[model samples]
Target: MKASEVMADLRRRFPNEPEYLQAVEEVVTSIEDVYNEYPSFEAENLIERLCIPDRIFSFRVSWVDDKGKVHNNMGYRIQHNNAIGPYKGGIRFHASVNQSILKFLAFEQTFKNSLTTLPMGGGKGGSDFSPRGKSDMEIMRFCQAFIAELWRQIGPDTDVPAGDIGVGGREVGYMFGYYKKMAREFTGTFTGKGLDFGGSLIRPEATGYGNCYFLLNMLATRGIDIKGKKVAVSGSGNVATYTTRKLTELGAKVVSMSDSGGSIIKPEGFSEEQLDYIFELKNYYRGRISEVAEKYPDVQYLPGERPWKHVKCDIAMPSATQNELDGDDAQALLDNGVIAVSEGANMPSTPEAIKKFLAAKILYAPGKAANAGGVAVSGLEMAQNSQKLSWSAEEVDDKLKSIMKNIHEQCEKYGKEEGSDFINYVKGANVAGFMKVARAMMAQGVL
Candidate 1:
């Protein structure tokens, strides 16, 4: 299939869904040549089928606050594809959640799951419900209400939904509890459940830890040691916090972390104590990142700013939301002699920023391959649940490391330049993942 023609048709059909369309265009552009080689794939219109989700579930979620006021929010679940295995992805709860965003996320999850070498398909569900400034009881009520509309559509083996953004362990617990009550059977229908109820060890830190592992692989190719490298990681969530922890353990200095409000820069590098404080600030107290500045005299908070442009570092990890890093941010990193960028968030870098990274031939790893550790571990959790047993933290951590290494190797194998040392990880990840899913679809005969 022609990339331009496919993207043009998609644009016409999905006129206002820029995020979903952008995801489609990126994958199709990278895999077009390989896709054209399979005549059966073209005859079956596999590319088109892959671009669209299998089904989308939209419902209204209603919940009551502590004040006895009722609220309504839009909830969605995009089951992108189940060609290889069951649908598996996260459920986000943020004011910004929408069809376009979840569609893009689900589409990206397809390839990300494929790269993990796990038996899973792509799916994403979320609501436009903001968890910020909400009481614990309110959040729990909303989670139950959200799941009430979706429990029937999901199962342990059908579609396993995990946590993302505003939905964490607490949200997952509430939803899973409600789902268990409604279904009247306890199953691993949802991942990221609390450890008390079948959650895997290191599940929260998997994505960040995995990104660091992938970066090590990338850096190792050039015989560069991670010991003395300075890293600027954005976002103060699980991914960002754990990324800092792992980097510090490896002797790298992480200079910054950020949230929606702004960034906190600790140029001397954050201590383990400082990282823990930031983590508790966000995860527990739900305080603004700016509070870090008030607590520590050495830390500087930049209001309404991201850490990329202001920090001079050897590596940059965009652990924040989608499109938070742009071409200008990329150029600034490049100008400051950044050697590598490993995404810990899905699609954190914009198209232009990716192009700049590719043109520069730096060790840039995309989210699909780099940030897949979370889902990889989720797949592990599924396995553990099926076995009715839990693996030790060391065992799970080993598996996570092995998976990240394999993902990095896959990128190297498919993304290696014909004659140059530069590797195009984006093309590699897309092509490799597409090939796997395409072959699976072909074998299944146009379902």
Candidate 2:
């Protein structure tokens, strides 16, 4: 299979779905060489089959607000592939969600799940409903209405939806409650649940902690220690917050964090008390990251900006949304003496940014490998739900670390050149994940 031909065809077919097209192009470019080695896979048109989702469910969700006003939103669930196991992914409630974004996410999730060695197929569901500024009652009503139409298609053993971005613990709980009512059974239909429910311990911190663990492995390959290393982290959501927490615990100095409003730069690094305030501001008060600058005299807030080009650090982690970092940001980070970059958000770095990183020979770990921790823990949550048991925080954390280490090993195996010290983690992750799913698909036969 030629990468250019496949991408050209995809572009013609999905002319408006830029995000999905970009994702497919990246995976195909990485796995093209390895894919050609299997004649049967090419003969069966496996590449085309894998590029497209197994199914897509789109519907209108209408709910009444507290003011007696009705609002309508588009909801979607992209069930990409299930050759490995059940459909598993997150439910994002941001206004930015659409078929293109969700398709890209679901496609990335397929390979990400395969890297975990877990029995999970790729899927993603979300709506264009923004949870920001919405009252609790309004959000609850929306969640119920979302599941009211979607509940019939999902189950504990079928598709288990987790939380992402606008969908947090509160949103997951709301949806789980509605699903329980409709299904007449309390099962693990969703992850990122409240602790009182069937939620697994450390699930919230898994992604951030996992990214840090993966970064440590990357640093170790070059004989570097994380202690006292200056770092810049973007996004103040769950991933960034927990990544900051874990980095602090590892003795790294995190100098910056950001939100959609802007970035907060603390060259002296943030204290535990400051982080707590940030957590409260974003999670409870729904405030912006600029508040951090106002509260602390030492910190500087760059309104309407990201942290990538503003902060100087040894490591950079883009935990924000897709394409937040661009070629200019990549150059800025490289010029500022950044040695490594680990992604905490899906497709946060643009193609140009990724190209520059590869050219610079910096240790760059893509989102699929770096952010798989969140879904890995979600898979564990599924297992716990099936057994009617919850593991201790330490146990879950240990397993998460183990999974991250194994993922790193797989990347090295496929990404490292036979005689070179540099590892192309992007290519490695894509090829490794693709091989697994390709084999499974081949064994299962064409559907």
Candidate 3:
């Protein structure tokens, strides 16, 4: 049950898939000690089985551009596991999409869904298609083509797909329309659909709000109040804006928000009015973070830099890309007296950064436990669709909060060390999530 021995085999087997290997290593290492305690698990080779996905569907997506130019992109769906429930995860449309990234995302999704206490398995799908700079028509055509191949492998009780990265409401709408047309059945096969359809209320704000709720729970454990706490949040997408919105509502100051180009820094923290402006900028106009600087003369935009370097706050939320915050950024946040870190994005903090946080004994909430809110709401959407009903915004929000609180509790149960008050959330999340999935796999037997 040595972590090194298992990691060596995974590295050998997945030579080119660094992201997937990293994800597997993190979980295996975290649960190795507990895994050893279960001799039956070792005999059944549960870890080895878990490392391999149940199935992977790969196909080519062909679409014509506005100018009638034909384009082809690789699309994939990694259906990792389904012992607990149906396959569930998001579809990321970005230039960085690949087998490695999607595999890592699907692997992480297995645990993230488990943390929600929802009956969802793990799956992820996407393409190397970049939606940025593409016109509305071009994006639609691309999405329709992408779903043409994906429609067959997914269904309401099969693999339920949501949106991620460049795949937003528009993209999801396009894909869902295509799926509905192709399948000739209108169902809750997709989670992030428009509200006019089967989408759940507050689904867009679920992840962000959930992160804060988990953060609040973490703070409560330490008897530290969130009021008057200055926070630094990165990314200008729905996750970032909504996280800022929730933090602001909870009496915390969110001083920074960032994008690929740079970060927008406001020493006095952004207001609800400003967040509205940002929402319109990113969501409606699809503009850059620099545009906020032009609209508001107070905030400064650091070109080609992450907000972590300039952080001066009590909390940090990296809602951007994977490994965006590294060891240096962790040091910067620590130097600025950051007491907690809530990750909104999958693997936002690098292993090095996570090590620093663990060493400093900060209240660090991994995305698996912290960002389960979105999927929790997605799960609610599934239930609503099944029951032919729709819950109110308040109902969905209450459910999401309860799910986040439960995830935090699970982390606390597994994360706390013997005779030590410090909570290792990463270890907690991995062990807790693995136990459920592993038990299910063992009972289901060598599938």
Candidate 4:
């Protein structure tokens, strides 16, 4: 369980996959006790098997833009593992897409999917094509072209992709349409679709709602309550919006919300009407957070800084992109008397930020565990599609809430350390996920 031992083993086993090695090292170092408890995990060569992905497919996507100019983008599908079931993850579309990030995400997905207790493995796919500022027709053409090459590699029973930061319901619809057209079959090959077609209710809100549910469990452990507590959240995307919605519903005063460009803080708390207007600006009009301050004279917009830097609150949720919060942000929260942080995005906090939170004994939930709700609901969507049934909004929301509670319990059960009030969620999540997949792999006996 020592850092040296973990690094040595990782380096020895995964010499070529630096991304996979870094992820494994981080999770393994946190849960070194698990390896100590089960020494055979290392002896039986499980680490070697688990460190490498089962398959990685790379292809070229050539599509035409609105200007009749063709562009080529690289796409990848990293099937991390399928010991439990078929691969499941989301497809991201952004200019920053790269093999290392995708592999890390896929590696994280393996454990995230396992934490849901669903029969899903781990996988991820995406292209470096940025959808921002593209016309609807241009985006559709890119999606169709991307899926034309992707369709041969994915299916309902094989690898099902959902939405991520850049890929939303629109991208899902476009991809699904292309898949259906090329394959000439109606199948639940993808999730996060329009509910009238094959999507499940509450899919859009699952990640945000589940994040609050997880934080609630963490608070319950210490007899804390979110009611009347001040909360600061980053990002105005689906996760942040729904997180704000649920937090406000639970009697928490959400004082701040931000997007990529800037952040806005309202001391009087954002009203439902104000939130509705902000939602319209961001979701409907694709506008920036700076516009919120102009529309609502009461709100204050802080330019070029994250909301976490200036807000004082009881709870802070980093719902923005990866590594959005760093050591300085963590220190600011700690200085402001923040108690808990639940990640709504993948690796939103840098390693230094997480270390600071852990050192301060604050409740910190890692993204892989906290943000698994999206994939969990996506898995449910796949189930409904396979069964040809759609669950009601309440039903789906209830299921999502239950799943979040279960995930929290699992983390608490495995992540608890003696003399530490702060739970080791990273360890809990990684080991719980690894145990499920390892047992499945053992049962199958080396495929």
What C-alpha lDDT, on a 0 to 100 scale, does residue 69 get in candidate 1?
96
TM-score of candidate 4 to 2 decimals: 0.95
Name the lDDT value of residue 363 in candidate 4. Answer: 89
Query: Residues 1-447, candidate 2, lDDT per residue (tens digit)?
Result: 999999999999889999999899899999998999989998999999999999999999999999999999999999999989989999999989999999999999999999999999999999999998889999999999999999998998889999998999999999999999999999888989988989999999999999999999999999999999999999999999999999989999889999988899887788888888887887678898988889898889999989888878999999989999999999999999999999999999999999999999999999999999999999999999999998999999999999999999999999997778999999999999999999999999998
Q: Give the distance in Å from residue 158's predicted Cα in candidate 4 to where it truly belongs.
A: 0.6
Whole-model lDDT, candidate 4?
0.87
lDDT of each: 0.93, 0.94, 0.92, 0.87
The runs of at least 3 residues in candidate 3 whose Cα sits more than 4 Å from the true structure, single-residue gaps closed, are none
Candidate 3 lDDT, 1-447, residue by residue in tens: 788999998888889998898888889999999999999998998898888899999999999999999999999999999988899999999989999999999999999998887899999999999999999999999999888888999998899999999988899999999999999999999998999988888999999999999999999999999999999999999899899889988999989999999999987788778888998898888899999889889889999999988859999999988889999999999998999999999999989999999999999999999988889999999999999999999999998888888999999999999999999999999999999999999999888
Q: Per-prediction TM-score, please? A: 0.99, 0.99, 0.99, 0.95
**Which residue pairs does candidate 2 place in steric collision?**
none
The digit string of per-residue lDDT tens for model 4 on 1-447 reads 465775797687657765556677777676566666766666676666776788998899998987789999998899999888889999999998888778888988999999999999999989999998999998999999889888988888888988887889999999999999998988998999998789999999999999999999989989998999989989998899889889989999889998877899986688888888877787778789999899888999998889887879898998988788999989999999999999999878888898898888788899888988899899899889989998898999889989999999899888888886667787788878878887888777756
Best by lDDT: 2
Candidate 3: the clashing residue pairs are none
The worst-scoring run of ten residues by lDDT in candidate 2 lies at: 275-284
Q: Whose lDDT is higher: candidate 1's or candidate 3's? A: 1
User: What ranking emerges by lDDT with the best candidate at the front?
Assistant: 2, 1, 3, 4
Better of 1 and 4 by lDDT: 1
Better of 3 and 4 by lDDT: 3
